[model samples]
Target chain A: MNDFLFRLFRNGETRLHELNYLFWECTTRCNLHCRHCGSDCTMGSRDKDMPLEDFLGALDTIPESHRPKGFTVVLTGGEPLLRPDITTIGREIKKRGFGWSMVSNGYFYDEKMHHLLMGAGMGALTISLDGLEDSHDWMRGHAGSFQRTVRAIKTASAQRGLNFDVVTCVNKRNIRELEEIHSTLESLGTPQWRLFTIIPIGRAASDPDMILSKEEMTRLMEFIALKRKNPSGKMVTTFSCEGYLGKWESQVRDTPFFCHAGINIASVLIDGRINACPNIDRDAFSEGNIYSDNFYEVWMNGFKRFRDRDWAKRGICTQCKQFRNCLGGGMHNWHGACEEPLTCHYSLLNAE
Target chain B: MKFFRNILKGAALTTALFVFQACYGTGPDFDPGIEMSFHVVSKQTGEAIPDITIMTRGGSESKWFEVGKTDSQGFAKIYGLDYKHNGIDFKFEGKGVTPKDTLINDFSKNFHEIRL
Candidate 1:
């Protein structure tokens, strides 16, 4: 009995030795094309669906030992749900005993679709909602996307089995509506909310005006401070106060965690391509085809490239103090190179 | 000699198990029923104002409670509030001041104050 117990504990520790995460871009096709979207995701894109065989083959390559204990697979896309075989992909992931999560625009929710996904062991569904009805619709470039998203949230929330979270991208257009968006979420009773800063790339590059200015970010942080002080704050807690504070450059220096991505978290693309993090693109780092190569080989080769200081030679990423923490400034925002360090207006406001 | 080595290994393992269990067992021993007093004051006048209401939200149950009025000095003390965490928010209101507004939130020590 003593020998058996000792081996069991030892094996458990050894199983969790490697830090791993997978981001599966099931499709690049999106229903709504938002103005500030860094991906430039649109309904017209030809390369939409990822072949199911390729996806499953990629999963088979990840050895059971190196597979993380609570192995997290994030299914993202132009819109992952738009793919025909998303539910099948979800089921396959669950069969391998891995946790499944998704990032969607929330326009594809229906009674049948919701049940299929929840049945497939979908752990969490993160939906995008830019602002209140008019503001959100305008930002998404669809007249009724806001209403559809609200209905989808209501539908998803009504389904007791489904876990849903709302993600709002803060930019110049909808910066003022932060409080209103919070109130809307409160009214809907959504459990979790995440506020992400916009990365400049794709359409965002053409319209520099869309990006949030330094002054706006400062005001937004002040409002968040006030909300924290409020006793009746109804915002559902998904992330910690410390986590939110680190998003600001001024507070980031004090935070102990330099980069949680590529170590604790990672992003896998649809074409058997894997990235070190979700916020980066596949072309940035294609270590090897996931179908042909094992995770160990790909991870080691890709991680070296990811950790490369060539960004310093490029002159954009090297000079920035927040480089260690920022982790290549979110993959979608990588637009070749500009003279600037791709600093978010929010960080610049607090920058010394 | 083999039997003796196995016995030594077992003893070391037992000691490590006990140490792990002890570390996990030691945690905060909090009394849920115990309540404390909260005070609110104006930063400008340093005078305790009357008709300010305070409430607690988020937890098992949401409860609303009234605090005391200020004396000569701008200080009102409200009691019988239990908090699981140190940081608790209190909303304050007066005739001229904004109603349903957050007053006190930061709680480093036991005695917490809201300066409007």
Candidate 2:
């Protein structure tokens, strides 16, 4: 309950407008090249690590108030652990009473990471999975990356303190293996499988083929529905794409709204700027730089300006009933790369 | 009407427990559709920015569409309308606003506010 949130709720405009989650892209340098990476993350020039002090100092700027629940700081990167100080960073963030979660390709994982993160007080560890092995390795552009990730997850989960989950980006190359991936996680005692609906944003936006069509996404949703009815009894499947559809979100409370991007969750780039959405064009959608500006002011004024726009009448999103449920999925295609609104394909497909 | 509303935690992604039963062609009815208005104001100040023009198609193909300007209350109302003004695009030409041209979306919201 920071001051910004207190004012927001006080004004009675508290419709999921509290910044609860923070996404810190610790580094853009990753060892494996995944085809569906929204950040277009890679090694070499992309490897600009955030100074540990800059990241930690930015935390102090977060307005402290009576929080209704715990705060979460999600550490992501080209593979966050590539930098040795990740554990230290994680430890510092946890010390602030913030829940800590990190996403990694898991190539650098060893027993040391498990112990380090566990000691740092990890809330969960999300590992990237494309398919089982062939599908995952193909998407990752590495031969044995699957073996590496599987081993990493196994080692980390062995410590009861560390929770393991799989984050899969569903694209043409690996849509068929959703079930197989789910079962593997279930077998591993891993609970959740978050399937990200690949939107054409970063490198993928240039290559339209990487983006899934409405039919493809709808079929995937149908598959998810089927899997939900039957008892996988182990792994749970959730879709990032579900946020775009017109429906009540399972995870969202009371409201039909989808994301709290500027409202609640915000992404901090390596340069210390706060972005509206993690997947948005980083340079364009930036609300403000935390180093020079106030995080709360930037988020309230700079970031949340999108919420003021008339999304219900915005192009393809206008006619659909679900338009209100999603605020055009966080103004995603503002770059104008796509021909139509991202969810229009579904509206057309569903209409058919 | 500001009709509202991702980080997945562990313990299984039980979406079944949390399902979105969304059906197309069915949602809130944007009644008395033609009667629409938008308020333009400074997001930083929360006060009105006057003299901004609001251009519109008024949901018709004919260029005999619609246009109006904001009153002292920062409010602008479309003059002539009978059916739904779904295609209305409010091009607010002002000095300090970010969105030069904002499409006036579904009147389901009825009263729209454009904050600069």
Candidate 3:
């Protein structure tokens, strides 16, 4: 059967069951310009930062029935700490009966911010740590960032119930330094660690050195598999759920490959546009605007493109035997410029 | 007679399995997209201005992409430009007016109404 007919008869991944996670792009301003930053956030970003009330007002638009129990709003941005009112935002989010967390580079985060945020109902944090000093500084395009981030990690990890996870963006430059980075994280008393390879977009799209080749990708997977198998420190390490990795799926990550963008996860961009995932291209897949449309209505009925996978089965995806299992990789992996999916773990492994 | 009965049962079982698989099949998951719109008006008379060109850039040295131009109603919009810099510079120019520049430093609001 054809793609449309098949989808019509079958219950596919396009269905929105419940809202478990929501990412709010609070701001687009960051202190550093990372080489592989998908959002290309810089210190001089011109995007206006949303006020605490704006996000709260947008949250009110999502009816309680649409969200699952204990739903959390994840605040992500150029750097969430750039906003002076982050604590107030967290407090307001808590007032609405939802938990809150943040994704940060750990540059400005310290003991004081952690205390303030925790008091304001911050439950978790995911901080980026690309590599050891030199490699990390180079990737971030800033000096002394690694030291500041490491200090923040230590502070966060020392606290109980902070649920800190140190995420590293693996690239050609840092691929060799994974072992050292892991050791550094373990020493910092990190509770969890995640590994993700760069998607070729933004600054990364222009820099060929930022993306890993098939062989290098295998090495990264093998390294993760080894870490998972070996008795490491107290830290629980897993590869990020960025794409399907065939045999490495169960070994590297806690669960099998799944792109939870629209179904269970959604994000509001700085410009008031709602999308399934933060990394997804806003031009092609925006569901609706928080300013003009009701959030619950958009969540329920507006993700037509997100819920359908029939169109993604073109190009190299059609040739892969794992297409049915991988579903053309993650939506973020689709390079609109090239009109083909990039970084297929299945295809990469098969190439070997 | 017994052999014919077995063949019918086998075919029925195959059809049932196919139907079950068809209804409960799995595939790839969710995605996203967004856009920002703008409106320009006269500062002196509060009249909607037309033919205004809105050029956007991430920073001082970043390349500029013409997001959109104001129409007869002074409305324009932008989406899917591959630039990722958060800080943006919106420069407005028209046939017979002083060029103006505005800064939206973060991903805050989508709709902007500017009076030139």
Candidate 4:
């Protein structure tokens, strides 16, 4: 621990601060499509997998100065593990001195595959586990997805250098089972667990009834509060859940910028398209061609365009009480439904 | 008392050596190089945007160079430029959106977005 602290604070060690965050969605194809997925992962009309050359070209655009000291690049997908070249991509990222992370369903954690990914600088693996086996399997639309996810967690934990976490989407169906899910993850020895409130988009948008009500959301927050105070409790981490909930009640309440999609976090689509946030679909938001444009140029120009918009100045987001914190939520949510304020109730509840 | 004073002196010397090592072990006058990358994307869908223009100017009459297009990841490489003394500008025009410009700085980091 002492050594870790020393390294963390070392002046020359670039790992101290993160300059940027990249969410690289290598492929939109997935084996299981969950009902609450914000990205509509189950949809069949998504872009094809990103080509290897295009992937490399994207990596090549990172400016030397702005490169993160502890650069966190998250490789996401319909199921990132399904991509045949994930190991190779992971290796290349590590070679360039970036911290690597992945968000997957955990259905494909084979021994060889895990080894290859770990070898390529896989720092953190976040597997989605909505609830217990029965609940998770039902939500994911696969009979054995829960079991496979648990196995993947165990396998990842048993590895020498891999850190594992579970991401849960809290909704009406699984709100009652959060405690059980927490306990299960803890028992499995997972290092961390993040709970996100379901954003009504993608499949969930098609079936708004699947979303949790304000009362249910409140209950979930109560549970989170209890878990936070209880050291021995099963809950490991609570990301933006509290804040998201708080923001949901009164749209006018100010909160920290929720979606810095364009500024800090970026998503790379399968066909080489880049987006500012994960919320927007490829068809809705195409900033530039990564293959032919300077990454910095396109990003800066995009930000300027976004900031200069009339809606940016006087949209529903402007009237929002929590504009400080919510910041129009994610762009996709804003673009998807203009009537709503794109605020996450969970985020508002946790506001400091 | 004399022996105790000598021991204290020795301890102080060791502490000084450790501090010196911590500060200067890497190098005495090492200049940390600036190495970073960025991604540019559309605000709505989170996809990469390409073919935008990036230009940098240092003085009043600095020449403008057309930086390369963004890759599949909406990322472009700006290699080995000293950002401390230079002012950078980016421009992009796409369908359904007007042309946009931004002044690049250190705080916003790499990934940028444009809305359409």
Candidate 2 runs further than 4 Å off: A1-16, A66-68, A159-163, A206-209, A247-257, A336-340, A343-345, B1-116
**TM-score of each model, in listed order:** 0.64, 0.67, 0.72, 0.64
Candidate lDDT (C-alpha), each: 0.55, 0.60, 0.72, 0.57
Give lDDT: candidate 4, residue A79.
Answer: 81
Report the lDDT tens digits of candidate 1 across residue range A253-333.
Answer: 211222333433445565666665544545655566666667556664456534443453334555556554443443334
Q: Least accurate stretch of 10 residues (summed lDDT) in model 1 chain A?
A: A237-246
lDDT for each residue of candidate 3 in A1-352, tens digit (9 for 90 to 100): 3334433323433442456678889999999989988888987788999777777777887887654444768888889999988866875676676767788999998765665565455766788899889999999999999999998998788755455688888889899998888899898899878888887778898898888888899899889889889948888778877887878876786655666667667788999898877788888788889889887778888776556666788888777667766677777777565367866777776664
Interface RMSD of 1: 18.2
Local error of candidate 4 at residue A23 (angstroms): 1.5
What order do candidates take by lDDT, descending? 3, 2, 4, 1
lDDT of 4 by residue, A279-298 (tens): 56456566876776766567
Candidate 4: list runs displaced more than 4 Å: A1-19, A42-46, A158-163, A233-235, A241-257, A281-284, A305-318, A337-339, A343-352, B1-116
Interface RMSD of each: 18.2, 24.7, 17.5, 18.7
* lDDT string, candidate 1, B68-116, tens digits: 3333444433322233334555656666765555534444444656676
Tell me the DockQ of each model, to 2 decimals.
0.01, 0.01, 0.01, 0.01
The TM-score measured for candidate 4 stands at 0.64
Give every collision pair in model 1: A23-A268, A279-A330, A279-A331, A280-A331, B47-B74, B48-B74, B48-B75
